[model samples]
Target: MRSFFDPRQLAHAPSREFHNGGWSAYAEVPARAEAILAAIGGTERPADHGETPIARVHAAAYLDYLKTAPARWLADGREGDVIGYTWPAVRRRPLRLDRIDALAGWYSIDAATPLTADSWTSAYWSVQSGLSALDAVLAGDRAAFALCRPPGHHAGADYCGGYCHLNTAAIVAQAARDGGVARVAILDIDYHHGNGTQDIFWTRGDVFYASIHADPATDYPFYWGHADEAGEGEGAGTTLNLPLAQGTTLAPFRAAQARALDAIAAFGVEIVVVSFGADTWEGDPISAFRLRTPDYAILAGDIAARGLPCVVLMEGGYAVSALGANVASFLDGF
Candidate 1:
């Protein structure tokens, strides 16, 4: 597998996060992509160093905002990273809000996704990483991996949340379609349902998105992730949601993959994107799932057996010390 990455991933470190009742360091690490790729023994590639730039998919206005928002925030008297404070912009209304802060909330779906002065640069690089992995498979790589950090899967076309800034998995799948595949599938195995991904592809039938996560009723993003939500418009019946109960074990997770695999098969895809998150493991600090380390390799091998070009995009894993090991083992298995 090929690993795609950019150096800017190190820029968006959160000073603190809510963990175990109090705030601890946000686990987005600088060395993760490189270390995980090295442990997996894969070829390394600089992200988005070619003719096609990485910012193409994002809205031009939002792209401009990300580029300048931090400076603007600083100019507005904020001293630290600007957390998207409140979302004032609603799709149905146009002339109701005018403040930039309001626009920030409007554009940002939730408070969890904050922006450092360097956030745009970091998110841009993350997108580059995803695009690079997509390009690798498009360039005929049998399979590839994007060792991107600041895990995205939570960010949608217009909303960012859940510690995610750019919906990397969706970008990769979209890139694959742009690169030539007619039918593409995204199998998100993150502990959280890929709300942004699901939302982005909810109305597009050409791309199928399936997620296995802790049920939203009992998990984060409680508003979405219900099995009954299915898909809308052309995407009806195209999206599959397998929301497992909390404390689900490895066997059940493995069993759940069958449903996802069935969805992938039904899509008749030539390319696949796997949103990989170690949070599902028993050791994760923020989650309650019970997957063990050994289960990772089996997961990798199982996905590898699908016989399509696959790109595994890193999502979330907060067990800092063991994080690299779990991810390394998965790629080694892949």
Candidate 2:
């Protein structure tokens, strides 16, 4: 398997995120890949993987902005994290502007995701890590996990949201499709409903998206995960949302995983891209599900046994302190 990444991922380090009705210091801070290397006791260096040219799946200008706009933000006198504009400002402003800083609000879909001085570079590299893992797959590695930071799953084709900027899962799924896989299935096991993934693949039939998540009505993104929102047009019936009520423990989550795997199996997809996120861990600060550490191993084992070549893209898991162990354990099991 391959772990793809670019050095820029280290550039965007968020100080905190909103939770508990206020902001708390970040729990999952991304240490430098060098630190991860040292912690894992790896003498061998990870191979360099190039930055992913996001235009392969997203808009060209958007990709350009994602690569360069953060500099514009920093250049503007405003410093620190670049957050989204509030309601009236964003919804009301429709005019196109050349100022990259102004464009950040337009490009960013929501307030949760912020572009700091280094957001673009770090995010772009995280995407590169994912793409590199895919390239390794193309080279015949049976499985790979891209362990970069700034987890991406909520980003959309033309929009950024939910702490995600580039939509790595979508990019990889499409990469598989473009690489000649007739059908690619993205099984998002992230705690959130993956509203962006659902939206991206909703009108395309070739891609199948099945998600097991916290029910939208009761969870974070409240309008998109209903069982009835099944894909539209050619994508009709291709989207599956198995939203569980809060307080779901490992057993039920495993059953739901089985259901999703079965559906993907039924779809006969040649490739599987898992939008992996361990944020559902029982102790996670912001999530509602009750999965413990070992459960991730079980889920990984199940996915591996499904017998499809896979690329596991990290989505979200903010307990940075324990995140590495949980993620590495799951990958080892997978």
Candidate 3:
């Protein structure tokens, strides 16, 4: 498989992660991309396709905020990284707040993702990595891998959160549609549900979003991701969520994969973009699941058996030591 990445992805180094009622070393770090690249060699740099592709899924104002938020914070005399302190309880119309402090809360969905000076550069490259991989897959490759850092799948059209600034996988999926793909499916096997991806295509039937993750009744991104959130309006019956209980083993995981794959097959999608997250491993700190390292290969093989062209993009996987091996096993099996 051709792996796509940009070395500049390391620039979005976040320092703090809010967990267990206090601040800790951010689990989403630059070493993640480093380890994955080391395990899966021969990574290629992505082409420079500017904000056009990103705007297909994200809002222009949101992109502008990501690009300039750090400078705005610095100008405001903030000494540290820019983080969101609050969010509106009700969904309201845009206020177009120019203040950096208010805009931070306005654009950020949660407190976990902080913006550094180079975050925009890193996130821009992450989007390019996805587009490059998508181009390779559309050009006739069976599959391609995008090692995106500051892992996406969490950010929505108007907000950033969960260590994700831009929804790279969603951008690629939308780009596939723009590139003439009639039907596309996004399969997110992350430990946490891809709430942002679902939000992006919540009302569109052309792109189906399915996720297999820890049940949201007791997991991160505490809202959304329920089995009943089938899709809205024209997109009804297209979105599927297969949430598993804590400490779930491979047997149930594979069973859920079977359902997700069957739905994709039934949808008759031309291609699939997998939000592959290795955090399901037992040792992962932020997630709870009992999947073993070899189980990743088995799970990936199941997806491969569907025989659809795939654009595999990286997502959350915090067990740094075993993350490389797990990711390598999935790609090798695929």
TM-score winner: 3
What's the true lDDT of residue 243 in model 2? Answer: 93
lDDT score for residue 283 of model 1: 79
Q: Roughly what TM-score does model 2 have, to 2 decimal places?
A: 0.88
Off by over 4 Å in 1: 17-24, 31-38, 41-43, 49-56, 88-90, 95-98
Per-residue CA lDDT of candidate 1, range 111-222, in tens? 5566777777777677778787878778888777877777889887766778877777877777777767899999989898888889988999999898999999888878
Local distance difference test scores for all models: 0.78, 0.75, 0.92
- Count clashing pairs, candidate 1: 5
TM-score of every model? 0.92, 0.88, 0.99
lDDT of 3 by residue, 75-161 (tens): 999967898777888767868688898999988878889999999999999999999999999999999999999789999998998
Query: Rank by TM-score, descending?
Result: 3, 1, 2
Q: Which one wins by lDDT: 2 or 3?
A: 3
Candidate 3 TM-score, true structure as reference: 0.99
TM-score of 1: 0.92
